[model samples]
Target: MPEVVQNVSKEGVKYIILGCGRTGYNVAEELAKETEDLIIVDKDEKRVEDLRDQKYNALVRDFSNPGFMDGLPVPEVAFILANDREANLAALKTIKSRYPATYVIARAIDAVSVDLLQQEGADVVLYPQEVVARTAIYHIRKLHSSRLALRLYDLLASWEGTLCIVTHLNPDPDSISSAMALSLIARHASHNKLNCRIVYEGDIGHQENRAFINLLDIKMERLTPQMLEECGYIALVDSSGPGVNNNLPKSTRVNIIIDHHKNNTQPPSAVADFIDIRPGVGATASIMTQYLMELDIPVSKTVATALLYGIRADTRDFKRNVTPQDLNYAAFLLPLTDADLLDKITSPSVSLETIEIIGNAIRNRKINSGYLFSNVGYIRNRDALPQAADMLIHLEGVNTALVYGITDQNIIISARNKDIRLHLGNVMAEAFGSIGEAGGHATMAAAMIPLSYFSMAKDKEGLLTLIIDPILKRFSEIVGLDGEGEE
Candidate 1:
């Protein structure tokens, strides 16, 4: 019989920890700093006593037995860190079955145990070794990024005169924020010697994008041929290569390129003095955030809000194709950001036409396998098509969504995919690259096909059918779907 330790006040205990081993003890010690409501349970009296000595609430009981957890207060979080795999699995199953609502975090000793724990209803199964290794790697990368930032600072310091930071046409938040961050870095490093300007070719039509620019007070101008002539060096921000989407001529000189999107085609790296293209990163804003942190620059509240919004928008609040760096930068910026401003930037009022367009998309949607296809007929707001596509992709069974509309003399297509196997941008490029201009990130892509490529139709339905049918057929074939079936 194990000796039962005196019960500590259970009034505020929110985290119930099973097992007082090294892992559990360490976790408890860290968590204890945050809250007083923590209880540690173990089968061994010695371990229980050790925890008690460390001033933690400890109990000696058979944690594997379901009855042992019956009378304990329902905790918000439960950690199962038993030394034996069988004991850990049994405790996890018992707690999950009894307290189905509790968030169970279990430690796994091996790969097999990790899978078994997850199967046994462990909400989060963590391998301590793997986590530690990842932490080490992340820190090492952080150091490398610091060095790279200093090198970039030195490089920028060498340049004299205006440094044009160009974004893709009709710049999104990611492009705008990235350009702003780069300009900030360049200005700081050059001590205002190097003049940096954000320039793009198209209109900022998206409501949220407009809010972001106005709220942040971002200064950007329309790009022209003459602008390039006066620029000492050109730096492409949130854009992979020149002439792909921007007004810059392909033959024009590009000194630097910083982008997070994967190049649809390989870029000529030799042409640019510096190129940092990280496709694994969720947003270009994250890449810029790292530079800001590495340089230890004081990030303004407005700038922090812009970067934060840019990251969240691009990553769909970290639900899309996000990486560890994205999460880290987001966390770094969260505290610095103005919450009220972020709310305003994110909660922009949508026009009634945008709402109607979304309704038309849902009504006209065709689902084949897990793919969704919709055409919003003719739309005045081209940006609304992508917004509609993003919304449609969240439907219960849909894994891929493609939304398109005829605007002016072009057919605009916006594609989004949650399925990891399909790269939507590559799909769009392959499907429409030959017909018109098309390219985007891995998960989201857009294409612009000129009306001249298709035969003119008399009515709206006829035009939609003529353009949308070929696109559906081509896209379906590319994604390995055969014979379109309506939902």
Candidate 2:
């Protein structure tokens, strides 16, 4: 168990458990150690007696009955663990409808029920069989000698054709490094049976990103529709769901997906045969690092440096949304990584256009209740918008920053937030998702709205108003502001 999980405290919280089956009993027993205010209810007299004998608060009543719940106190947490699907559903509905504020967790018997329970207002739905299978896999991998990696290798070894590893468009350090690490894994796993190729779409225009790719010698091909059709197996790294940010078509059959984004709107199992999406993990490189460690694969200095940089970039040098796994992997990769090469990658020469973009952002910035917005007119290097947004958020009075500019056929928007209460990705999605594809992490997000969405204006100033006005209007609606005019 991780130290973080073990150290979680449930002090002063009340728990109400419905059903006294093996699952419920076990949960109540464990939770009893955390808090004293626990109530266990069961329809069976024998099960109720069992809890009573153990000196636990027990009630003999139908958990699905609204009368039974009406007499009880509104608990902070409620658990429905009935074996019958209908009974569990009834209990879940009752708890949610009666105690709307309570956090309810219900047991699910099958994969189909998981979705149903969630739709019915269960805050969390537990599937024991799936949990057990996952736990078994975890233990089997740990106890056996490179069993998980070997199993993955065996699967790749069976393939007699090409394997394509795809990364998100405008590949970041995490996406690029993760693809390289997966390619390395495939090389070690199947020798030469699987011809693995790394591919991506969009420009690597960021100075640091280009330097990282060049210094590490990470080779990636530009993905095309024809190339995708020729591959036997497709693996997505640091990206989940097709047709989102990746170049892969929605109908493309994927064999594997490894990503750290928790808010993947697509059902992972539907798109890939082998899915490993760990939202708790800060970076996909950390996940790949664990696999390398488990397989005992030799980590070359170049690979180490890339993986370390991936983790650092994703976590913002461990200053933003970080997890224990990221810290552990960073520690593991630190010694093997080339420090001098890392410094070189980090200190790339900035372009004059990027400097001018930042200057324009500063001069044209507008602030509304701690939220700063900037329009850096026509920018060739679209990547500089994000760099400027990140810099603008560091201003003393700013809690959030949005920077946008016109480039080619798209109006690119990059957003950053220092406020923990705001999810910038969701904000971006709400503001411009209908016009374009927009989504990202909590602190950092980006949106690309096509130029066709705006009415073409003849002059520069008219075009600026035509392009930026709608974006500001939508954003202002979301943040509850009455339109802060341009500075």
In order of appearance, the predictions have TM-scores of: 0.69, 0.67
lDDT of 1 by residue, 359-392 (tens): 9999999898998988789888778888899899
lDDT values of the candidates? 0.84, 0.83
- Residue 447 error, candidate 1, Å: 2.6
Off by over 4 Å in 1: 1-140, 359-373, 392-401, 416-427, 438-445, 452-473, 476-487
Worst 10 residues of 2 by lDDT: 1-10
Q: Model 1's lDDT to the true fold? A: 0.84
Error at 92, model 2, angstroms = 49
Per-residue error at 276 for model 2, in Å?
Answer: 1.6
